[model samples]
Target chain A: MAFQILLNIAIAFIWMLLKNNFTGVEFAIGYIVGLLLLFVLRRFLNFDFYFRRVIAVFKLIVLFIYKLILANIDVIKIVLSPKLNIKPGIIAVPTKLKTEWEVTLLSCLISLTPGTLSMNFSEDGKTIYVHAIHVPDKNEAIKEIHNSFEKAILEVTK
Target chain B: MTEIVVSILILLGGAFSILGSIGIVRFPDVYGRLHAATKSATLGVICIIIGTFLYFLLVQELFIGKLLLTILFVFMTAPVVGFMVSKSAYNVGVKLWDQSIQDDLGKAIKKAEKKARQ
Candidate 1:
């Protein structure tokens, strides 16, 4: 992943030097051009892993964004309602992720989603404490988190 | 054609920002307000930044590293700042809404304290 990113950046630099247009659009075009070049050279470079990882990351981002919008709408609805009908609570979620970076990314993802906040990790690092605004069924909510965010994060990061 | 799209995006971003501010004004408690600011406000800011960047990318014809950096900075910092604020509030014992249904954290704290005292 890092190598591919570095390659993309190097291509952009070369493009800027050639076009003499160091603007954002030019850089973006350069990125596309770089991607194409990479595609053409894939057989020699064996860039299949990089391509698959990039696509997986994009899919994970899209899924997270979709959930974020849905969660935001839910928060807006709760706030605008005549009565405050929220059932706020903290949830202890045990995680299979063993690395600090993975746990940090998971926490960031959780906190960004509307109506949910990632509080802290247990000292042992095996569990995270998340606070959510509208959890009716704790087990179900945990299941959904595991199925969507956790799984997608692991898929992309791994 | 690009102008029209950027304009609409800018409008949508402005509207979300307004809604987020309204959420801040309308919410009952600190947690509610945190929800409004962190989620809606972050999205609103991201949208506006993205729209502005698009405008520059297309109409202005200047590729700006700063614009992209600004968006990335906001995306990374906003949620962490929000998390810090909420964590401080919770640690200081800012009460949840009276109608809140659960207290898993409170329970956990109590258990931790008991373990410490033993």
Candidate 2:
């Protein structure tokens, strides 16, 4: 992914030099040309086109921000109510992420999202111990993690 | 127009910060407190930083790379701090609130101990 980005930038710079136009717009045009060039020659490339991963990563960030806002709203509601009613619990959230960075990102997102904080990972790294402010149904919390952050992460990494 | 937007963002950030403080004071346990401290505070900082970024971009007509970097750094590190604090607290045997409904980690620890015995 990093190499593809560098290659794209290099193509943009070369285009600028050829056109004798060194502005941002000329560079953007070059970038598009480079993107097309890469796309046409993608079969020979060792990995997937960089834009696919880039788009996936963009989607993940959007999903993360959406979740963060939603969770913050939920927290506000819980905090403002006159009655203190919450079912805080430590649940063993099973994860399918294999890579070290994948697991780390998942855990970090879990800690940031909703009312959950990832306390620790199990010995085998298959499960993360998460402390959630509200877990009325354990299965629901687990499913939320799996379907949202974990799925988004897999899209980005795999 | 820029002033209105900046003010609103700053107010939102300030409100979240106050809410986070209230949560810290009201929550019953360390883990719960971690949630309050980490999520709301991080959001608060992000909001304030964004507001400042906008202010500098529009009012001062300068793009400050440092503000964006600050936002990124905080967003990345806040969770790690929360994770570390809660993990260390757990390691020291800090008790959960009485009202907490589950303790899956305890069960996992017990299972590990049972496996070790065999």
> What lDDT does each candidate get?
0.82, 0.92
Q: Quote the positional error of residue A150 for candidate 1 in Å.
A: 0.7
Worst 10 residues of 2 chain A by lDDT: A71-80
User: Model 1 Cα displacement at B40 (Å)?
Assistant: 0.6
- Residue-by-residue lDDT tens digits, candidate 2, A38-123: 99889998878989988899999999999999889988888788888999999999999998889999999998889999999998
Give the clashing residue pairs of candidate 1, or none.
A23-B63, A24-B63
Model 2 quality (TM-score):
0.94
Which ten contiguous residues of candidate 1 chain A have the minimum total lDDT? A46-55
Q: Give the C-alpha interface root-mean-square deviation per candidate.
A: 1.5, 0.7
lDDT of 1 by residue, B1-118 (tens): 9889888888877877887888898876787777888888778878888888888999989888897899889888876887788778889999887867787777888999999999
State the lDDT at B7 in candidate 2: 96
- State the displacement of the C-alpha of residue A73, model 1, in Å, after optimal TM-score superposition: 1.8
- Once fitted onto the true fold, the runs of candidate 2 whose alpha carbons sit more than 4 angstroms away are A1-3, A23-25, A40-47
